[model samples]
Structure formats: structure tokens, C-alpha cells
Target: MRSEEEVFALLIGFAKSDERIRLVSLEGSRANPAIADDEFKDYDIAFFVTDMESFLSKDDWLDFLGKRLILQKPEDMELYPPQLGNKFSYLMLFEDGIKIDLTLVPISELQSCLKRSDGLLKILLDKDNTVKEEIVATDQHYWMTKPTAQKFTDCCNEFWWVSTYVAKGLARQEFLFAQDHLNQIVRPTLLLMMSWKIGAEKGSSFSLGKNYKFIQHYLAAEEWELLLQTFQGSGYSETWEALFLCQKLFRTISKKVALAYGYDYPNYDERVTPYVQGLHTKCS
Candidate 1:
């Protein structure tokens, strides 16, 4: 595996050698000073180039990076439509186990790139001094913010409403369908409510990390255990248990958040809970 220094040297060296590759910047977790350094962190790089077509014209240029175990060109794929307009990316995992998500941006789009940036960027090379201001990287853009009354009510409503789908699927013995709704909709909505409660207590300056990965650090021991219980086994009984726990946890946290913010908590849970309970009773 290539060391971080070796990877940086190679990336910077390649950018300097190619006049077409005018500017290079590192983005994502690598650029954020708050994030701890780890081997798993991908080299999220952006290259502002003179001619994107010339680079796209051949696969040989990427050979200079490393011997890839596999590569995914999102823009070149049919199944997943490209989301980055006027930009292309190569998601490469080298044989040595280092992954690099390198994006190529047209030089003409530099201003727009800066505008769309999430404030986590460290410029490595700018040959023409195109960037006059200092690029201070911060993860503040991703930090948790206080939720509005409307947003809080909406989250509660979504949680209670979609939860019915989970009950319906389980009542029909459609395990996969129930699991999908629980995992995709119900749990995410619960997480949102949890994060709002965290924000209310901790203030809005800190982040819970992507997908609230750092959420457990903030939760109470019993609450955390309950949250874990919501991720249950394959059995229908277990799925029902998970759904009930999710409802209980969401109700507890959301009410606290509502109290803190003085927002009127919606009564959807009052109506939805009995419906779900009835379905479970009928199925049993």
C-alpha cells in the first residue's frame, strides 16, 4: 500500500507534469482538519483541466495513477445516470487497497465550482493564480442545524405515515417489503428526529457525521441500546418488535425536541400507533 506522502507526491507530480491539468484541489474528509486521518479515507481530488475531451479520449492517462483493482466511471455508465454536469469522475480502487475518487472539472467552470463547493477544499496547485482568496477547509457546512417547526412536524408525520407500510408488509408476510420500508424510510426518519434532539441539546455547531454515524456518542446508554434493538432479526415477530421500538424511541426524542423548541408536536403517532397495533394483533 502507498503511504499518504507517496500518494500526495504522485498526485501533485502528475498535476505539475501535465500543463493541461492546471489546478488540483483535495476535497471531502481529506480536506477537513477536524476529521482524523485514516487509511480508509479516499484521496478525493479534483483536477481543473484545459481540455476534458483529451483526457476522456483515452484510458492510458489513468495508468499513471496506479494499477487499479477496479474502476467506475459514473458518467460513462448507462444504469446510473450522470449527476455531475460538465464534470467527470473516476472512482478507482488500486491493487494496493487505496481508493481515489478523482474528478475532472473544466477550467471554464472554476468559478461555478467554487460557488458549489461545500467549503471542504484544499487547493494543491493553481498555476495561473486563478484562486485569489484563501481556501479554508471546514466541515462546518455539514454541521447540524436547529430544525424549524414545520420541518420537525414534517419529520414526525413522515415517520408515522410510512411506518404503516412496514405494518402492512409484515401483516401480509412480505418480509423483504417490510424490511425495506423499515430500513429505508422509518429508520431514516427516526434518525432525523434523533439528530434534531441532539442538536437541540448540544447546540448546532457540531456535526453528527455523514448519515449520523457519530450519533451513538451523543445518545444515552439505554437510548442507544433501544436504537440498536430497532435493528432486529429476520423473523416476523422480530420485525414487529423493531417497528414498535422505533415508534417508542421516535416518540420520546421528538417530544423532547418539540418541548425544547416550543413546536407543537403532531398527533399522527396517536392515530398511527393503534392501526399498526391492530395489524400486528390480526397477523398473530
Candidate 2:
């Protein structure tokens, strides 16, 4: 494993030597001061260059860095579809265990990059000073914003209402569909409500990070355990247990959010409880 200083020095040195590469900016956890540095943290780097074609045309250019275990060129592929305009990316895992997500964007698209940037940006090399404004790399992009009245009501509605889909899927013995609705659609709303509670506890100005990864740091022991239980899916029995656990956790978290935020819990919780109980009885 290469030291952070060595890896970073190599990155900047590469950019500095290449005339095609004008500006280099780093993003993600590596650029976040709040996050502790670790080997697992990717060197999320972007190089603002002149011609994207010459670089995209060759794979050997990557060999200049080091031996890579695997790499992904997003813009070059058709399957996932590219979101970044005039930008090519190489998500690389080196043979030595270093992971670097390197992107090459035309300097012309620098404005667009800044617009979409999550603010966790640091300019490593700005030869021509192509970057117009200074970037303040904060986690502001993922902040637990004070939800609008409609957003609050909508989340409450979604969490309680979509739960019936899980009940229906379970009754039909469609475990995958049940788990999908329960875990994907319904669970996110529950997580949002939980974040709202955290925001209330601390301040609404802070972020919980994406997928509520940092939520456990703020959540109570029982809450964390219940949340963990909500992920219990492997076989049919496990899926059923997970669905039930999800229900319990959702009810607990949503009630707190409803009370704190003055949002109404929808009436569907009453309908789904018996429906799920009946299915459990039938399955037994």
C-alpha cells in the first residue's frame, strides 16, 4: 500500500508533467477534512484537459500510473450510460490495493463541473487558473435540510402508504417484491425521518451523509439494533423476519418524526398490520 503522500505526489506530478492536463481537482472523502484519512478512501481526482479524445483513445496511458487490478471507463461504455458531459472516467483498483477514481473533463466543461460539484473539492494543480472561483469543500451538499411542509407530509404518506405494498407482496409470497418495496422505497423515507430526528437533536444545518451511513453515530442502541434487523433477508424465513423488523422500526421512527414535525401518520398502518399478521398466520 502506497502512503497517501506518495500516491498524492505521484498524482500531482503526473498532472504537472502533462501539458494536456491543465487543472487537477480532488473530491470525495479524500478531500473532506471532517473524514479521517484511510487507505480505503479513493483518490477521487479530476483532470481538466484540452483534448479528451487522445486520452480516451488509449488504455496504455493508465499503465503510466502503476499496475491496476481492474478499471472502469464510464464514458467509453454504453451499458450504464454516461452522465458527465465531455468527461471520461477511470475507476481503478491498483494491484497494490489503491483505488483511484480518476476523471478527465475538458477545461471547457469546468463551469459545469463546478455546478454539479458537491463542494468537497480541492484544486491540487491549477496551471492556467482555469477554475473561476475558490471551492469550499464542506458536506453541505448532503445536509439534512429542513423539509418543506409538503416534503414532510409526502414522506409520512410514502412511509405508511407504500408499506401496504410490502403486505400485499408478502401475502402473495412475492418475497423479492415485498423486500424491494420495504427496503428500497419505504425504508428510505423512514431513514429520512430518523435523520430529521437527528437534525432536531443537534442542528438542522448538518449532513447525515448519503444512505444515512453516519446515522448510527447519532441513533440510540435499540434504534440501531432495530435498523440492523430491518436488513435481515436471505431465505424466506429471513425475509419475513426482516419485513416484520422493518415494520417495527418504521413504526417507532415514523411516530417520533410525525410527533416532532407535526406531520400526520397515514391511516394505512392500521390496514397493513392485520393484513401482515393474517399472512404470517397463513404461512405458519
Best by lDDT: 1
How does model 2 fare in lDDT? 0.82
Q: Write the per-residue lDDT of candidate 1 for residues 145-175, one digit (tens) a residue.
A: 8898899989998999999999999999999
Name the regions of candidate 1 deviating beyond 4 angstroms: none
Model 2: worst 10 consecutive residues (lDDT sum): 201-210
Q: Pick the candidate with the highest TM-score.
A: 1
Candidate 2 lDDT over 1-284, as tens digits, reads 98989888898998899999999999998888777777788899998999888887888988867999998988778788888776789999998899999999899888877887888999999998766777778877777776666787787778767877777787788988988898788778778878877876678767676677789999999999888887777766787777777678777777776777787777667877787778777877
Local accuracy by lDDT, each model: 0.93, 0.82
Instruction: Give the C-alpha lDDT of model 1.
Output: 0.93
